[model samples]
Target: MLISLMGYSMSINLILILKAILILVLGYFAVKIVSSILENGAKKSKIPELVSEFVIKLFSAILYVFVILLAVGVFGVETGPIILGLSASLGLILGFGLQDTLTNLTSGLWIAVMKPLDKDETVQIGGITGKIVEVGIMATKLLTPDNVVITIPNKLVWGSPITNYTRMDLRRVDVAVGVSYGENLDNALSKALELISEHPKVLKDPAPAVVVTGLGESSVDLQLRAWTKTGDYWGVKGDLTKGIYEKYGKEGIEIPFPQMDIHVHKY
Candidate 1:
């Protein structure tokens, strides 16, 4: 009788093992089928690539967990207590060790959703200026004009002030030109205004304005303010400076230089 009982226990264990293996195999194919369906649906719906990728990954993780649970069930194992214990342990560890990571990830999600800056938008954040290349889950990548790559933490980006240079379709170019104290301020101002007006990239709606900003030590400070398309900003700025120099020279507008008089007394 004892031998018969031992034989029955062994048989039951073997059956359980086979059941577990069969469940795992079935789960594998189920997961594959679900993933394929998701991909097809996403493609038909014309979902954004990033959104589709995220959805697929999320579903895959869910399917993996389900497969594990099914395998455990096949062996007559209780999973409720195990799941509770795991959740508690994971929460405690993540709370302590991954606080900053979670913060960055949340902030990055917010930025992606809000889209404060788009790809290729020029932005200045955390004292670094560059064109946005990619915005990831924990950080943002930038490509500087000099071809340098900069990665900034999402927490810092969300916490600090961001200056988006290309936010507006048009921007104002602020240029300062100085002339001799005794020169005709009117003529200098008119000539500077003319130079700005003649630039093809400069906007005409707002109209360029020249004003006396202040009196410097050796020259009369004049500010030339003009509106230009954001795309043409750099070219217009550079050309405007050269144009100012040449035009002022032709108009006999003297650009004063800093000078100091030294006095020496011999006793």
Candidate 2:
């Protein structure tokens, strides 16, 4: 009788093991089908690749967890206590060690959705200015003009103000020029406008202007304002500045230097 009972127990265990294997196999196929459907839908909706990839990975992780629980239960192991234990452990880790990591992950997801900055766009965030290289699951990568790659946590990026320089079609270049109080005002203004207008990169629709901003102690401070294509902003500004200095020299316009004449009397 004891031998028969032992044989019966062994048969039941074998059946359970086979069932567990089948469940895992079917789960794998289901995950693949769902993932493929998700990819197709993402393409149809024109979703950002980063956001779509993150969603697919998160969903797949959840599905795998469920599959694992189901397989474990088939072996006569109770799942309720296991789930509770795991939940407690996860809560403790998140509350202590993973708080910042969780914040970065969520922030990255939001950043990917909103797209405040895209790859290859110049941006200033949290005082770090660089072109975006990648928006990852937990961080954003930026490549600075100096050829430095910076990895910033998404939590800080999402929290700070984002200045996207390349998103707009046009950007205004402001050049501060100071002329001597002795120079001709009309001649200065006219020459500045003519120089900017003649530049190939400066846009003509809005028109360029040089305006007297203030009267300084030694000179008249003027602002040279012009609009150019976003990509041409820096180039135009640099060229215009150099052109102004050289033009002023040839045209006899005086760019002032600070000077003070001191009077001394013998006591």
Candidate 3:
């Protein structure tokens, strides 16, 4: 009886206004709760944090709009047609305004899914060689060898070929050794093989090969093919080259240099 008397005392219009206000306040709080839950779910998915955060932010915005419409509808506002019309107009405007951004976003999605490259992997892409620091929805961050941070748009990165050096377990080092044409090819070949085998970093399983690749203007070019752990490739090449020079000088092997043999014609 008390509740009925209070309801009758409040004007019907005033009661509806109060109810609308209550719905709006509750909807605002609900939006926050739902946004928080969605953000938590995104984090749990274990994808890139930047991508997940972006996706969650977009989702929360749409949810907030839905909540606002629900609150408005409680006040006897016809929101369905308004919402549908506004959504189409807004979509068109946003699509045109954010065309470039959408391109990068789609490219980022492809990167996340295709995964041709990954974080912490050293790669050369789009003329930039560096270690991937972070892959975001708009751009990817890389730490270059010189310690400079480079941000490349995901669209450009996705369009280019990525060279991942660290992807392979082993790498082959090719060093060209030239000996005087007069030097015995057999002796030079043996010396090249010996130098490669003696190097601790060179993998003995491949059995370093020395072959006559070409004859240069002044020397017979010998190509030394050696396999080594990718990490040790440079070290092996440098150390073995030094060994070749020292060994050649000791064994009287000649490394030919540029010189022209002048033929004199006496008439």
TM-score of each: 0.74, 0.78, 0.65
Worst lDDT 10-window in candidate 1: 1-10
lDDT tens digits by residue: candidate 3, 65-150: 87777765654556867788798987897678878788888898888777777788788998899998988778888999999999
Error of 3 at 237 (Å): 3.1
Q: lDDT score, residue 194, model 1?
A: 87
Residue 166, candidate 1: C-alpha displacement in angstroms: 1.1
- Clash count for candidate 3 is 0
In candidate 2, where is summed lDDT lowest over 10 consecutive residues?
1-10
Top lDDT: which candidate number?
Answer: 2
Off by over 4 Å in 3: 1-90, 93-97, 259-267
Q: Give the top-scoring candidate (TM-score).
A: 2
Give the alpha carbon lDDT tens digit for every residue of 1-267 in model 1. 112331232224767778888888988898988889988998888565445544576578778887888787664456787788778987998889988888887887678656687688999998899999987777889999999999998899889899999989999888888999899888888889888888888888888888999999989998888898999888888888888889999988999877788999999
- Of the two candidates 1 and 3, the one with more favorable lDDT, higher being better, is 1
RMSD after CA superposition, every candidate: 6.2, 5.8, 8.7
As for candidate 1, its clashing pairs are none
